[model samples]
Target: MVSVCRLVGLRAVARHAVLVIALGTGLLGAALVALGVVLIFATDVATVYFDWALVALGAATFGVSLLGVFGSKHESPPLLRAYASVLLLLLLSLIGAAAALSSLGEARIDAWMEEHWERIEATTLVVRKDQFEALLADHVAALLTLLACLVLVLTFDLLLVWVLQCSATSRHRRLRGEDVERKPLRASNGAGVELEAVAP
Candidate 1:
């Protein structure tokens, strides 16, 4: 019975790890989407902001994943939980920064539009009003898409963290030593082999 419980606990932990990895991947996707949106609307500024932001987010996610992998391999519940929290925070911060940047971009664009309305109308302004409207519409759509991605990423990360914490708590209860107990093997004589369990 104990062995069976241990096995179930381990399975839960494995599932949690998979979830964490999936959330991490989602965060990366969100970052990429944000970068794409910035490039589309504010190329020059985005080139500078997104380049560093991407690098920071990528490195942080990588580090968190590495920690998680190590924690799983070693069966360290505390370490796993810690790393999961770190990943969650990093994702949240990334989303917050992206939102701030988007707001700043919108403000700047609004200011420019107000200041240059007459000049823009007087100058070539090659693009027609409809075309300009279409472009602006596209930009808004992209921004919204990026925001959605970020929200999804954050939600997934939080879910993963919650699952991991639950799994860790269950595993901690079943912990033994350096190794978890396994199902007994049937011997030729119908005897079962017993094994020692490990702690978390």
Candidate 2:
């Protein structure tokens, strides 16, 4: 009875969590698509590039969310695993990006400062070498902060992917009418009940 109750409770929680994640993904993808469409009409080439990037990301996210929804509903282990794998890759790439940004090249920093120096000079009443160095440091810090936010988001998404996989596994086993928690029985119950499970 305890096992049955625990299984039921877990399934209930997992089902709701999966639904929330699926819905969130769908909404976020849709928003990105909308943003891309808005940017597509811009005259600037940079905006055009950004639009395409957003569109591609939105499409991929939409497809992944579709797979997640379908797999959760149908209890497909392969689909769930695939989704998890992709999310894992995203997390890894975000980590790599953060690392790269933290170690950004001095040449690149110098070039950026060179480009912005005129603007900085015009805006400031006083400017010195130390002030320029401080500005460069601040810009680097800002970039790192942005990358950190992205990494956090990726980490959270990966966690949700893990939950989705577990939910799919649970549903699959339950659909097959397998016990949620089962231990193999031995010939006789002695001082030591050698425990083993035929887990899926």
Candidate 3:
């Protein structure tokens, strides 16, 4: 028979999941840092700088994962709040990125592609403008669609966890009678005081 402590509740599962996410995030961040180190030695200055930026972003993500893992495991309010705030910021940033991408309309995409067509054609001369455009369009669409799905899933999961945390906290507070809201009713003469019902 399984022990009582071995049987986990939804909250327990969520807490463990946070640690798992943290582990994965940390690994990804390490990989990015390694990649950035390699890229920094590349001959292309611009590409090296771009890789550095990715490394920075990866480091930030890794930090968030650490905070999330610690918060979830220890049930630390401050850490949990910080993790939630970071997720919110990431969600907003993703939305902004999506908007910016969408704003790069078809005309802009075509124009941008045309500007680089010479280099692209040098690699595959047989590719026609229309065909290349169509392929690029499809590729971009697929990427955006996948990213949108990911964002939606992340948003839902994070929101659910945050809500659950807040609800659990409030429930505990109420149980401890610390969540009682006392309403004061005083007479105009200030001779008497009335206490209204306290709602938790």
Off by over 4 Å in 1: 1-54, 72-75, 94-140, 176-200
Q: Report how far residue 44 has shifted in candidate 2, in Å.
A: 4.0
**TM-score to native of every candidate shown:** 0.45, 0.58, 0.63
Q: lDDT of all predictions, in order shown? A: 0.60, 0.68, 0.70
Query: Tens digit of lDDT per residue, candidate 2, span 1-200?
Result: 35754877654554455556766887889888887877677534333245688888998888887876776566577876787677678768878877876776767767777888766555532456567677767787787787788677657655655766776677667855755344354453575666555554
Please write out the lDDT profile of model 1 over residues 1-200, one tens digit for every residue: 35754877645655555556655664675676566565547654333344555656565656666666566555567876786777677677768866765776655766666677656545524445556555765687577677778677656655655566576677677664323345443335335655444322
Put down candidate 3 lDDT per residue, 1-200, tens digits, no spaces. Answer: 13532586556666666667667777887788777777668634334246678779778877888887777777666777888887788888778877877899888988888798876665534557788788878788777786697588568647645854775576567756753454443344465755454443
Please give the lDDT score at residue 76 for candidate 2.
71
Best by TM-score: 3
TM-score of predicted model 1?
Answer: 0.45
Task: Itemize residue pairs with steric clashes in candidate 2.
Answer: none
Instruction: Give the CA lDDT, 0 to 100, for residue 156 in model 3.
Output: 61
Leading candidate by lDDT: 3
